[model samples]
Target: MKPILYVGNINYSSWSLRPYIALRWAGIDFDMVEVNLDQPGYGDYAIAEILAFNPAGKVPALRVGAAVIADSLAISEWASETGSSLYPQDPLARALVRSAVAEMHSGFAAVRRDLSMNIRRRCKAFGLPADTVRDIARLDALFAGHRKHAAEGPFLFGQRTVADAFFTPVATRFRTYGIELSADAQAYCDTLLADAAFLAWEQMVLAQPATGFSRANIDRLYT
Candidate 1:
């Protein structure tokens, strides 16, 4: 049986986008079910539905037969085992990729909090918080270092890997918030935004009906 992936709103669920893009990039075929996270009664209905599969009651849960895989990184690893190009062959390179993916999975709280992923909305003249600025700088440095060692590809560590999938939402965040990036970082974001899979996701996000929920703090930052 083909795997089934449960996702949340494409406009705001960065975690959901991670595995969705990873599976697409890895050429893994799967069925996707979108849960309306912004809808009324989401906590009681959507959360309950997701909790049946994932104890954490989170989006981006993957179900393969009787086994359920929770978390984006876990799903990415599973895809790699199935001949997906989610990691490198060399031990050292694979380790580096894993490290990057792990950092993305756990770090960048300020960026995630301050600039929530809203693909459908673009804020104008939004000044980032000090912590978020620092996070963006770190991301620039990380992308630069990886680009230097990459093997003739636009993606980090050369070609599309799990690391790139993990950071894809960050790229969209940079665009939505009008955050400035260094040449290398901007190019990396450009490459991701230009990807067919990413574009398809964006199109899907745009097609979705608007959710009434809004982030007041983020909106306040706008001019």
Candidate 2:
């Protein structure tokens, strides 16, 4: 049987997008199960549904037969095992990619809290908190540094990799929040935003039921 990817609100769940993009980039076929997290009884009903498969009650859990992978980063790692495209083939390059992916998987608290991942809405933000500003600077530096070494392609490591998958949502956040990036970083952001798999996810958001949280609030969540 094909694996099933359990996800939450696609527009807001950066975690869900990571593995979804990675698998699609790797050309691995899998079915998706979207758990409703915006409706009433979210604590009782939605949480229960997620807990059916993931004790953490988080979205983007993967089910492959009897085994369940319960984290987006872990699921992306699974997709990378399929071929050399999801990660670089060279040892040093692969390690660098892993470090990039890991940073996205675990860090960037300010961006997550302030910007959120509201793909359906476009809004401008100004005079952001200090932490959020710092995060954006870090993003610019990271993207610029990666693009300099990206001799093979537009993607960070020259070709599509899990690092790109992990950063795609952040790219969207930058666009949605109107955060400016350096010329090099902005070029990389353009490449990520225009990716086919990323576009497919956006289309999916467009097609969700009216009740779905595919439509997000335009307002930023931070002070």
Candidate 3:
């Protein structure tokens, strides 16, 4: 049976973007079902509807036959099919990728919360909270540390993996908030932002009606 990926707003959902990118790179064909988180009158009531499929009440849920999988990382794992690491070959590489993906999955709450993800908007970054600054610094350091693992390609693993997919939303957050990065890290972010799948997602976001959610106005609803 064909899988159905229920995604949230591409403009604001970093979690949704993660599994979608993983699915794209894995060349796993699936139908995308968008769950609009808010609407003219519904506000956040629309978000609660995801409980029908995802008990967690979050998006990026996947339906495979009779089984429903929630959690962005879980869905991404299914897409990659090499465990959470998504790199099927070398043990060391797989472990490193897993560590990185796991870090993205559960850590960096500061960057994830403060910067957030607003793919279609750009803003001057300033007044960053101390925790957020530290998060960005750690992210930059991770980018530098992980680059040596990639002996060839621009991606973290020499080829795109679920780790890179996990990082894509952070890259978008960096861009949207104008968060400065080290040159190498910025280049990595640039690569993610220019990825064809991501570009297509951005275009799709452009076509959708404005939800009136931006970092300038809405703080948490878009996330």
Candidate 4:
């Protein structure tokens, strides 16, 4: 059986996108099972099914044979350990990558609540709050720093690392929301948008037959 990941609608599940991006960056093969997250009782049975693999009852859980891994960061790390150098191999570089990933995981609550991942739709002024503004500024600063340090390639630390995976959704959010950014930041976003894996994953998300997503909302961001 192929390794499987249980996820919610790709149009809105930012957390799920993290690991999906990582797995793809690592070039690992996996399967996807989508749950209608907006539907009632979406998880009662889904939880049970996934708990047979991951007890957390969360979407974005990874099933690798009998080994169950839950949570995006954990799954990304697991993917790194299994096959690819998802994180930087050097100790110091690995530390920097992990720090960036942790910052991504722990911080940005404001940005998350303000700009929920709605890929199929867009919103204007975004109604973002003051706190979210502060957080966004901070994130931009962090990304700028990474870009300066990104000597090797377009990726955060010269190459694609777990840190890039951690922020992949944020990159998408920035694009979807029409958030204007600095040249460096915009360049990083371009790299992510240009990634074949990201594009493929996005195509998969957009192909879902769900309804209610508003293209108008999304267009306003770009306009």
lDDT of 4 by residue, 1-223 (tens): 9889888778878889889888887778899987655554443645455455556667788888987787899899888887677876689988999898999999889888667677666545556779988988888888888887666899888888988888878888887677878788888878877888788888887887646534223333324
- Put down candidate 2 lDDT per residue, 1-223, tens digits, no spaces: 9999998888777889999998898788999998777765454534777878987777889999998998888898888786446876799988999998888888899888788887876778777899989998998999999886667899988888889999999999999888889999999999999999999999998887534342344342432
Candidate 1 has a TM-score of 0.91
CA lDDT of each prediction against the hidden true structure: 0.83, 0.84, 0.81, 0.78
Off by over 4 Å in 4: 41-53, 213-223
* C-alpha TM-score for every candidate: 0.91, 0.91, 0.89, 0.87
Give the Cα error of residue 77 in candidate 1, in Å.
Answer: 0.8
Q: Rank the candidates by TM-score, best first.
A: 1, 2, 3, 4
Model 1 score (lDDT): 0.83
| Model 3 ranges off by over 4 Å | 39-48, 82-85, 214-223
Where does the lowest 10-residue lDDT sum fall in candidate 3?
A: 214-223
Better of 2 and 4 by TM-score: 2
